[model samples]
Target chain A: MADEQTTLPPDDPVRFYQVGSFAVGNRLQPLDLRTVQAAQDRPNALTCGHRACQGCGEALGARYALDAAVRATDGRLVSVNATGCLEVFSTPFPETSWRIAWLHSLFGNAPAVATGMAAGLRALGKSDVRVVAQGGDGGTVDIGFGCLSGMFERNDDVLYICYDNEAYMNTGVQRSGATPPAARTQTTQAVGPEPGNVFGQGKDVPRIAMAHEIPYVATATVADLHDLEGKVNTAMGIRGARYLHILVPCPLGWGSASKDTIAVARAATQCGLFPVFEARDGEVVASTPIRRLTPVDDYLRMQKRFAHLFAPARRDDVIDRLQAMADRNIRRYGLLEEAAR
Target chain B: MPVQIEGSQAVARAVAACRPGVICAYPISPQTHIVEGLSALVKSGELPGCEFVNVESEFAAMSTAIGASAVGARAYTATASQGLLFMVEAVYNASGLGLPIVMTVANRAIGAPINIWNDHSDTMSQRDSGWLQLYAETNQEAADLHVQAFRIAEQISLPVMVCMDGFILTHAMEVVEVPTPEQVARFLPPFHPRQVVDPDDPVSIGAMVGPEAFTEVRYLAHHRQMEALEVIPRVADEFREVFGRDSGGLVRPYRCDDAETVVIALGSVLGTLKDVVDERRARGERIGVLGITSFRPFPRDQVRDVLWNASRFISLEKAFSVGIGGIVSSQVRASLIGHPITNSTVVAGLGGRPITKASLHAMLDRSARDELEYLEFLDLDRALVQREIARTRVGTRSGPAAENMLRDLGAVRSTPH
Candidate 1:
């Protein structure tokens, strides 16, 4: 149960003993080294019997992040949620899947609400209680951005976790500020000359959070449960505004197989479309190198939203543009081994 | 102690005495000084254990108060005019969630013409938003209402909006009996939330209620406001006992007994109407004034009782329904539905236009003689309105009406560049 063993060192030889280093749990590793989800008695902050879609990455991501936060705060944690799939699915009046103290304020303002909860708790001499605000990409990157940035500028004691499922999945897959380029959404149709979401737009919220020079800012994905849980834990340890932009793939919105949620998220990171990295005070301290460099097509072909680019005369030009974006990310974050780079 | 202080400062001191745990605010005209005072008190350690948050916008201020109140903290915030409109979505959310957060809306005119002056348009816009709207007639009532607002809000578990006229009350220096902490403590008990975000007994505070339960949930909110109709007066009575002054209640009837024509108004406009009524009464005109402190939970029964025997009544409104004319008068008319009371709506003091004694004397003389229109715009520029109406009829595009009116009045250049 030592603190050192809780984090799997980069050079640990035991990483290769089982499925892989990216696996959530390893039987060969000790209890402390395993992910919180691997534990039998995890808090299950976003508990069972919710109405999320099959293989919903946001549901898993919320559970992993909040359970880890609960473990870090010793069960003294409060969650403030924005009106999104997470808030709607988890609590549907007279019933709720959330076991921890939770609140769903509005479509936006979770960050400010969490800031208030922290302040209120502190004022009441209950500083031991910690706060976490969460929302989807639509909430965090677009509608709630002002409040989130304000929380960051004030450095309020709250950890805001964004479960980024790319688009506004709750509103039936409309385009959001976090929606990737050339992705077919409800608003961004696939029949036009552009065929999907336009290029040269969409927010990079993790980078935006880093620009705030906060105490902690990290990009995580549901593909790596240990990484996501670890990031939440690290954010919980900090006393100021900490942001965790977790890339949670949506099976319903992505038009992918329900079972390929983790696989698609893994392909996103492995192809460098979504960078997994950590920053402190606006400086990149570490990044998870892609173990096997994959093409952006491997990530795109799994989802029907991008199926337009593959069929009816292959849009090699758009695919190449996407690959270029991934390459740019790889170069920017150094998300590859020396030979691959 | 009774001291001559600005209305906002007195309210801040009264709020500090009540011991709010969180005070979130965004700077807006009129309401800015209230939060500024609270911020100083918090920073200087005068108000210990209080967190003063300078939010980015009015939305964040209200949202933060929602969070603080949900977590069982005594929360407070203030806004006015467009700032109130900006935070309006959260305003409804706070009340819908039944968070007992007290907010001060320094009542001002909502803009298109863009005026920063005193009016009730802002608070009237939120008359149905489920917050208990308490209008103050003077600096003393404005300060005293804060102490009672907290108690009443906590008692019924609904948000309270303590509204005072923008610059007329918020900026005016007047004698206010600011209560002591001991008096506030005796009157307003420590917050014991009906619902709280406590880890020991974890519960979801704001859940998504579907069609099956949404109506019931809203009805419950309405039921709580009805409950406030009782709690407001009880708390105001308690405040009187503790602070030794009459402050907040549903309505304050001034010389209504044996009166024929009763004048009705809200906020600081009531002070002017009361003075005008006193002068008329001195001349043996048998006039009376009724000041409505609570706009929401509308005090229907009380209003009906006061105006029941009166032959006629005049509703002097600072805000009206624009197209429909008379926001408060409409409610007053609704309350006196069966009664055969002749009523008139006098829209006055709009956008900081001074309601001088001369104008009131003319208007009241007309009202007493039954020579007033059903919907009268007191002190309106008839020529300017006529010119604009004529221009609109002649041309398809009249530019903007506000700009045109300003130009016609020589408030701006007559020629467009």
Candidate 2:
């Protein structure tokens, strides 16, 4: 088996085990090669015992990303958070789950705050300490967009992470700029001629960050722990402004089962609804290929947000349009492996 | 050594001497020259170890300062009327978080007619924002107050806003004794933040304080301001010993002793008020001018003590509460709850109309005769206002009041819409 694996090409897709590269940890892999989440001494930047809902993807994604960041910087990290679900849940007045230096300034100023943190640290002659700003989709793509763009434009030494949960979950699942088309949010009610969010709305913040020609920009999902951790590690390794957009499925917002958060996020990427890729200086450097192709219906049917499209009658017209979106992403990002294609 | 310099440049030099670690700049009228001066200093390497950020907006400028100050950097920023209104949220946040940031407010009128002129409306609008406000009466005071502002802010862990009239002070050139860096360093110690974002010691700074402890947090903020009532005068005294200048205090009582009536005011208007008082005193009128330097933590006791012998006092306000009479007079009334003192509110210099000696003399003469209205507008055009009111009553569509008034004054060509 070892000899056969050795003979395989570097880009070969075939693997001996069922889990293959999908598993976070493998006995055959070296300790350094294992994912940061699977490590024994991984810094639990967002430690347990917080007010996050069961199977909360933002909590999980933040832990994976921030832990990796802390590791990359050798435990020297200060995070500035915009007011959102992550901030509201993690630090409730006198209690906090954060293990690293964390700051929650306002709903729309995290990026600028992080920029100031970096500048402050540099001015204080503490160049080794790094800054990481974080916020939910509502905070990042909507209210915090200008500050984020400004931070990127200035090439500030800070890493900004956006945990895209599609809607404003903390505010009871209101439609946000990161909400997908035709998704049922509180603001985008499921009772209209064209039920749920309208098409041709919302923003693609990762692409916007890339447009700044920043040093680094990447998109990840909570389902891919290794990829998310690796992306954060890569981001922390760079100096200038870095953006990481991680798709964190909100079980409450999406009306998916608590245990299905990871599966839902998996379906999002595998179905090509969200293209996981990395870019450098306005150019795509790499993209994660889909291990298994999943249909858009399989992804949509799992969430009650999209249940309106399936029930009352299957709106195949809307479903087909969503499928087209997935196909476009698949083609654009080259998300399918050659063998799978 | 006193050198002839613009007020903004003098302030910028004083601020630089304090050695702020970070200075965020977002250009707005009047406040622009102050930040521009600092930016030049940063560029020239005269201000070493300072990160001068040219931010996108006033909101970002204040936000950046909040972050910088939270991370143990002595942060500074400047803004004006509309700019101050824009960053009002972060202004409250900085004070609530107890970050000792020093800001220069180039006082300008808040506008619907969009006038970029000097007034007390900007800082007056943020009176309850938990920031200690010090109004500068002169270019020299504007420069010296900044040095005292940083010390007072850091000592109490509350933000301080040093307010100077926008174009009147910011654009006006005068002989200002900008303190040396050595003098500033001696007065203002290295920033030792009460709470900071440190890797070795991690603590959440701005948290989601619910109703359980929210009131306590706010009460503590108010408590800190009350504490500042003592710190302000003490720091001013310390500054006097170190810098050899009495630049800032709760109130500067000019010729108030044994006076029957005191003219109370804030900002550069006090300079004119002082001149008016002197002229009136020369005419055998027992009148005095009390300049309020520390407007916030309102200096209630000192104001009451100074006005103890006085029978009446007039609050000459540049900004009033629109529907209500006076912003500062209300506080003055509150201070003299049962002191048998007659209080009046004189709203003057709305949208930067000149508060000249002639207008002051006329207003004071009326006050001395006890014929002035309880709430009066100094030099207001009553005929123009009556005409506009009559026109609005006659026609449903009276056009915009500002436009009609401007046309009446022949400031702009009247085009029928």
Candidate 3:
């Protein structure tokens, strides 16, 4: 997905302008401030040339967060991934675009495997290094939820990152526990009276993580690379069982154009559906406020999965339920920026 | 260290001695005492520096252990019967990820009738979960094998499940010569995580592999398991040198060489069978017992080589595959298909029924008559069950299908017992 950009320096200068806008990035402003991903000289942790569909928010979120993590640690990280779309599309056999030390764990046990790694490192007296376990929504929200909670409850010395792509895209666009209500997936058909995923079902994993009273817990969207990177950097600063759940929209799974990954992810947050927030010691300590409130329908109308919601007759009830759900999230997390009025 | 201990406590001591960094488990019948001992150990600071996670359910137990192991910890957990089945998904993931986390499985039967008791059905059901499965014939062995299980699992980078007979081994107490931490440390080195999460050299793990490479991945897991055969022996030899006990490493045989009839089985039932064999030996019957300690690696060659010369082999197992036969019976038949001996299978002691030495002796004696084929149901009490069912079915025409079938056969002459 890379094109030769023979322009100024490879690093995006926009990061510099945006650095002072947040408390997180400002901490690293004096330290050369090179966007690790933009530095062509450095390794692309999630390297280029892999079949992650266009506008694949998971891919973008993973890359930006990992690159920033690479930059944060000065190149001393090993990652254990759980089986899912991110794993399927990124590394197809012997060919891997990953330029980091990586191991693939089963679909439901990335946190457990990462715990082993952390323990192993401690045993070896390698205290300088840290671990980050990652998986897709299917692996994290459903299959690996118990494991994730266990890690938090015990305060394990590892960070778990769940790339929340609403459905199991690699497995033919099936519904994952992270899929929003009224969103159509291969498994959760759009033909039913309720149409799409039931509103009450599925997990609010980040809130669940918060309930564990963990050292750190945060949620971000791939739409904001700087914010995503900042969360990763912040998680790295903590030493216990930390969680960073990123809202990564899958273009293929959501049935949207590849270029709309960032847009969709951003829309998810702006519409007050997927709140961008962080929790510490079981409290919502910080949240990226929504600058402008967009209608939940605006976000849904863009994706084919939500196409049924806007059918010939238009099922406004389904849209209203979705909006209510988003509204609930907004009310719970206080997503609206104070001065947005 | 010496202490008054039940089989579960002994196993717990062994786990503590092994110095697992994380212990995640749930309470299950027969297996509860073991985790209770562990929880006590953790709370009392007897087993310090380990994360003791008391999870909500068996599923959570396994899942928690998985997370603990994933983040570079010597992880451990335990379960039995239905609890094992409940955590089936996480159990598979544990081994598939090649995490060297040790787990103790108290063997018990899966239920439809809701009976909570001893049986091999639980451990046998997960025979192919890719974890190295080890069976213990006694509480001492159960305690000791867990130490070796952790070392062997980490050495081979494969998960290991140490199976002990539910209630039989887990509930019974015996004086176990527990190893000191100093000795266990020498035997089992601290787990060195081969793959870990690091923020510095940011990497991704557990990446999804598609159908194109899934087969090869399984193939590699199989290869690693095969590698365990060699690794186990080395670890066992080292264990013996350090602890001064011959664990028999893979399989334990009981005087099978000169015997005409050999009773092959696993778990604590072998102790009873051994006594039965001794009694039969005094009666001029040349019979012996073969206790299989390792089930996953199957110990195929060792099994064949050990019992190859026996004129007849009676494979005794505690679990059945419903419409089929005994789980171990089928495995024995498959392993001894081309062997020199005639193998007979016995399905016995299901749902924690007492497996008496008399019945075991009778089973071996019956097998010696050559009336039993490759598979036989032992101590079934089928006549009594049939009579009881017939008596109940008399006035109940609306009974279940099986019961209805019995009713349909109305006055067919009851067989003389």
Candidate 4:
């Protein structure tokens, strides 16, 4: 990581981006594509003064996407939230930070609830209002996955956005189906010979969503605010069940510096570890290209949960396997927006 | 106008006329015909303006309904027995979130020795859920209750579970007053969810409540359910005023005044028991019948008043409380703890076994003879129990696991069918 060095620029674009412009915060993008950040207008659709934890990536991602969605729809969007950290932290009975019409559903059934909401709105001749159903990875990839698949299969008129932080953060960091490989979670300990999580396991929901062929399926990262906002805005344009799974790194669960939220998230995409791409009907149609590919170690080294792999002298094999995974993702999705070889 | 129809068909027709925004369902034995009829209606465009989500499991069914409801729609769903238990979590949330979704539960027994018959076990399991619960005594009541559920649920911003006896109400066809779409549209206004997901007023729902506010939130649910009693009567009065019928709102009494003997029950059992009561009346017996149509509200005060003068009370239930007595029978007994009435619990007609008229008359005869037995396993034969014991040791020293192992090894003697 960055070892408490004061050699950083006087005005860190990352800090400014949260308050100023979404595009202003990046240290890796070219000057031409460097656009203003999402919070320049301080929409704060999630607002402030809720119970979200420090450096909560879900909190950040939700606020950024929702405010952008509201802006895009021009106040014609309604959010159906599933029971999870985002729902719990934002609403505290009789009080809410949300400024939009919101409906809360069960932990494992947000997709179904959102489908109902959309149907309800349509019944009332209010099809102009778009529906957004949201939940954490635990709710999305694990508990509510079946219901989510049904929504997609039926092509329900709703945009389901999964703020995936890998684990069940609200319930004390247990292992979720979306929990990354070799992650030190409470359930998946770092004790086995292969260490944390065994490879070749866990549900790859994006590919599953693609199989449904429900018009649209996209994956984004919180590191790229524009990409996330763009995907949400695009999903809203579609009439059927649209899925957006965003990788939001949790500071508490990942054991990373609170400030490294965007930085770590950026490294994940840049290293080709978490491919950012959009697919339609099971085929990859578009992707956010990685201009400069970084080493997987750069991303893994920043998080203390992955510190075990680097601590025991050196784990060349483990690191190599991680790199291989990144390579496979890069080749599979063609995430690099740059020209192909 | 009122027309004779089966309870299941009445529910199906009412749902079709109401034109729900979405219908999610999963089949469970006795409750299968309700959804099956609904599916037919949806497929034939008889029930237009709805999406019939045929889910893989009951959990998915309820979950889908929850999603549809949250989107600000009039969602309708149904389930029974294992299906009800499977979707219990979503069922609780559908109520707690105050989504005015209506669900019809066909009461049936849960299984281990796997039986698929009618019972109150399933509904009793969900008694504490915040959904406004109402039981139907006849096909007409079952049909009328669906209309009332939509009205009551929409008014209170709560989910309502309209329970009907499995097989009895579900299979039997009778005359039911079917309201026209225009009349129903007027009686039950289209659902305008109090809490909606609007972009202009962005907010979160189903938020976690810590120790600070969990109790108060649950208390609010409690207060609303209690208030359902007030809303129920008004809706029923409205139904009566429009359709000129009072079959399915709350408890209905039959010859329960100044009587020495009273029989209390719910669902179609009342119809049969009423027949036997008439038979007994012709023979100069001082017996009366009190059919409890609303089980969730329990109707404790009304129950006491109905049976207060009776010397001996008999409770017949298709479902029983395993370790105790009849579930409803026990509840009725508990309500009369301070009052008079020698109440005896008799369980009958479990797992789809037909509750015959002769059996009903026999149970009454037994109660009259002071031969009232507690925890009477309805339709349970000793030969079957012996056969089961010979095949599997459930309550034995070997335990179920050992019996299973023995069966796997072919060591246990197989019984003849």
Candidate 5:
């Protein structure tokens, strides 16, 4: 698995400037072509030495987004964080893991707080100081949804980023508003008849965010650093109520290998389970074509949260149901380049 | 100049005078009129440079205040009853982060039975929210307190809640000396927050506090609130000097000296209590009244000092701690430690129940004779409660007690659900 390349066709046109043909970094790329991450002073926004699990997708996702945001704003981004795994793990008393200006308010009020910060800056005539508010799936999709929606509806000048890890990862992997169907969370256990999470529930925040008719709404994953950074930069480029949702895989919550976070995230997007695209004013402007589509198990089989469906008689019915979801997303977003194929 | 205006209008005017930068408002009744007036002022270009945000909910209202205040914009908002409860988390956040946000709480009863009138339950529920609480004795005081709330909150970098009785104060027009903008400007200078969300100096304003610093941070907030005990009186005195009125203070003791019976209370109920006390004074009964201006810093020592010589004191309050008796009474008891004065608690005006002058007269006369119970509810229908108690004992299931009471009183026009 370690030696394998991405499960995409060679002619997919998704080029990677790899390090030693294995690692992702700036080794031979030209200065401007390279990501801000490859720069000498790339604003190590969530700096090193703080506590984040090994191969944490959220950590990578935040690093990409904030660096791009910091670059876009020219070091004038005051980030308001919602209390979750990212805030808890990155910062602990008297010590912080953030390089840029950051604030960690309560879980559900990040958007409103960011709104306030934007209003504050507006009032204080500090328009240069752009506001970026970030939170986990629980914070963004569930608890903080009202504030987020208010921020969107008000068209507040904020780039709200939701690091979607599917469940309440920090608080023992509880089911959240963004938890995928047929997934086992602490709250939605595997012992139930229908087991895991129910299908008809959970919010499609990217779509809901689009419904707000906000200036910008986009979805990205840590597996695609360039896409993630590109979306963040695009969001920062806009002025009012922008949202960038990143599906960052949690090894701890998902019960997957710490080293396999990026792989899992990549599989989720590639499997068409999590659509990667951008939208403006409630209309879909672009969808990242699925270079290669795989069964939902290609993503779920790696995570232990979905291990129940695999072992003790495979739940093919559930798997087919999930695969149908992926297919629906594929068809809806036109994720496959069928004509090109 | 003095003008007759509703408490809400007065507050709106005072808030305008304070020159609030961001006003995130949601219309909850009684609290509605204040924002209405402010919105009108903003629309008419009278309140310029203010961002009149029409938020969807009370939570957003407070969150907007938190955001606006965090960025060094003077923020203001208003709520009452369940609206206050809805934004309880943001209420704590505003004070916890030490954002100098000034909010007007048209104090209303929180509900299970759906009350929309005056009570202290709203603010009482937020007693430990790390905010400075001020209750107004009159519509005039309610209006004037906003001017002082901004100054005090900014000075300490903590949020302030100026509470006035919902509907009663908010609706009732009174002769209030609405201070001119110049006078308000002289009293409350531009908000100079101690800390702000500045990109130039990027300090993480609200960091995740772990075991190590969480206690110290909380203690620091507690210490700041203690400092408010001193700052409250000074701010009120300074307010009086500038505004030409003795309105805002920790406690306003009227004829308490050489008194045998003193009555202490919060909000506009004190005016009625004061009238009763003055009547008793004319009858040569040693009685007085003390209005608690600042409820949260409790004003314990001032209350203790002023009521020192009284033979007995009664805490007539709008809300109680349910099974624990009086909310303010419990604090009053904790404050009057060394004194051996006989004290009683009059838990009145709950769930929008009115506290009338006749009832206060009877309650005060009972307290004068030391015949008042340790805890009493003013104008309570004991017959209804007793009937319910007896019905429960005898196995009568008439649904819930409130419904049963309504049925017992012949007020129910429809079938019990």
Candidate 6:
């Protein structure tokens, strides 16, 4: 089964490109491909002082995703927020971090609500305005999954984005349907013989979305701003159900350094733990290839949720099992496209 | 023109006449026929320009209505007991967000053992959800209420629940003088949303109102609901003038001029209660009927003004508040607080059991003697209840309480054919 080799970054100096100079709006660059974040007048859909935990990957992901959506729609966008970290942290009852026409409904109903908003807009002949529904992992994969599937099946004209940080970060880091195996969560404690979360428990919502045969289904990470932004732009170009899943690293829940948030997300993709890909109508269109593959331990070692395997005595079997999962994804999706071939 | 039709179909036509642009619903009995009729009309091109959405669940149906209503499209949906309960969260949301969505609630009983029969328990459980609840006394009234629901909801920017007795009114075929489409158009004006989703003048709807303003927002809803008591009769007059029918109003009274007793109730049971009152009046008794059309705003002042002279009133209703006796009776009693009418509740026709005229007469007779209990189950099997009680006393599980009673009495299910 192990026909392919996992290669770490070479010992020699490697090539580097202008990766994130355009992290903010590249005012110095041409307007055609400029990021909304670079534009001085860009709509900061999420403004300041969100109560998101320090180095919150969710907050970063939301801003990137929504800012791009706003730009794509030419500032004519309405967002429905499912109840989670984004809803609670941004809106503590009276205050809100949103600067756009926003609605915060109960958890798991954002997709349905957004579907309604889209239908309402079309009925009113305001089809030019777009709608976006966003939620955290717990809301997306667990509570709101049915509404999401319904939206896709109906081909509702709305984009549903899921910010996946593994567990229910909003409710004190309990395990959600998106939680990775062997990850320690409040509900999936690292105490029993199995240690952390039992193997093969969580749902593969991206695959589920693909199976629904929606117009677009994409997986991205907070570390890849360009890829995330491009997918959002592509989604806005289509006028049917679209799903965007972005894996974000929670500093508090993962027990990682706030400064290492982006690094953690990068390691997740580079180690083939969360294979980044895009599909259309249930068919794989393209995927971000792993430039330099690393072992699963390289990604897990940074997060405290997986620290138990390395503590006291090394749990090589647990590491091997987890590596097999990552390798399986790599092979199934052909994540190392040309390199594997 | 007067035509005999299934009450569900009649209400469907009535709702369609209101010219809702978007119709979304998930079928649940006895609410199924309404949506079925709507879908047929939609398919036949009779409902042109209407978008009929077959949603996956009651939650999606209400959510679709919310979306349509939020975007300024006139929206309507229908559901019953479990469906209503399924969409309960969105029900509160529709009202809280101030969306003018109209939904037909074919009132049925909620269940632990799972019953789908007629009862006010469904709508009763949602009385505090901040939507204006209107119960119909007959098929004609139920049909007419749908036309008015849109007008009142749109005018006040609030959702309305037009409840009719499940099966009793939803499935029963009856004579109803449904107004012509043009007449309904004139009576119920086009839905002009007070708030809309527009990029030109965008405004945040369904905002997260915190403690600082949550109480004030709820207070506004309460005040607006209270305003319906006045607006209800006003619209009813307009509806009568345009449609030439005496159907809907906050409260309707019959033969109460020289009455010493009044039998009050909601929904179709009110018609049977009125019949019993008429028979008593024929003989030498002085009794009247007060049909509470608007059970939500409660129509406290209007009811007090109508039944002011009655010495005693008995509420023979299809729904009760479990530990609290009655849902509508408490409101009736509170309305006549300063007045001198004695109050009694007779919980009847639970889970689709028939509320016969003879039972009403017996209850009225007891009320006249000043010997009626505060709360009574109209035709409860005493032996079965006693047996269950005895079983519990002996530390044994009273298994399938209702079925045990039915078997003990050698009785099967009952449905009004």
RMSD of each: 2.6, 2.8, 6.4, 5.9, 4.0, 5.1
Chain A of model 5 scored by TM-score = 0.92
What are the lDDT scores of the predictions, listed in order? Answer: 0.90, 0.91, 0.78, 0.79, 0.86, 0.85
Expressed as tens digits, the lDDT of each residue in B1-417 for candidate 4 is 667777787888887778788888777777778888889988988766677877667887776677667666778888898889989998888788788888998888787655566777888788888877788887787888888888888898888888888877888878777767777877887677787665555556666577998898889888887677777778888888877778565677787786788887778778888888889988988888888766766777778878777898878777766667678877788888877567777777676677778887777787778886755765565664565567554445545643555455565333312
lDDT by residue for model 3 over A71-137, one digit each (tens)? 7776777677888777877777667878877777567777866665665566445666777789988
| Tens digit of per-residue lDDT, candidate 6, span B256-355 | 8888887788888877877787788889899888888998888988788877887877887788887779778888878878677677888998888888
> What are the per-residue Cα lDDT tens digits for candidate 1 across B31-89?
88999999999899999899999999999999999999989999999999999999999
- Writing each residue's lDDT as its tens digit, candidate 1 over A1-341 gives 34334455866655453464457345545665578877778899988999999899999999999999999899999889999999989988788999999999999899999989999999899999999999999999999999999999999999999999989999999999988898999999899778999997569989989899999999999888888888888888889999999999998989999998989999999999999999999998889999889999999999999999999879999999999999999999998865432
TM-score of 2: 0.97
Clashing pairs in 1: none
lDDT of 4 by residue, A1-341 (tens): 12332344645644444644344444344432322242356456788898887888899889878876776677788787877889888888767888777777678877877776777677667889888889999999988888888888888888889998889888888889988788788888877676776675568898899999879999888887877877777777778888888888899989999988988998998999888888877787888788678999999999987887987757788888889989989888776646531
Which is better, 5 or 6, measured by lDDT?
Answer: 5
Clashing pairs in 2: none
Each model's TM-score? 0.97, 0.97, 0.84, 0.89, 0.95, 0.94
Q: Tell me the tens digit of each residue's lDDT in model 5 across A1-341.
A: 13333343547454653532233454444454468887787888888887888878899999889999999889988988999989988878578888888887788999988888888787677888999999999999899998889889999999999999999989899999899998899899999678899888469999999999998999999887877887888888899999999999998889989988888988898899999888999988888887777889889999988988988889999999889989999998889975421
**What's the TM-score, to 2 decimals, of chain B in model 4?**
0.88
True contacts kept of 1: 0.83
For model 3, give the RMSD to the true fold. 6.4
Query: Worst lDDT window (10 residues) for model 3 chain B?
Result: B408-417
True contacts kept of each: 0.83, 0.74, 0.48, 0.77, 0.67, 0.43
For model 5, the stretches where C-alpha displacement exceeds 4 angstroms are: A1-31, A338-341, B412-417
Clashes of each: 0, 0, 43, 39, 2, 3
DockQ winner, 2 or 5: 2
The RMSD (Cα, Å) of candidate 6 is: 5.1
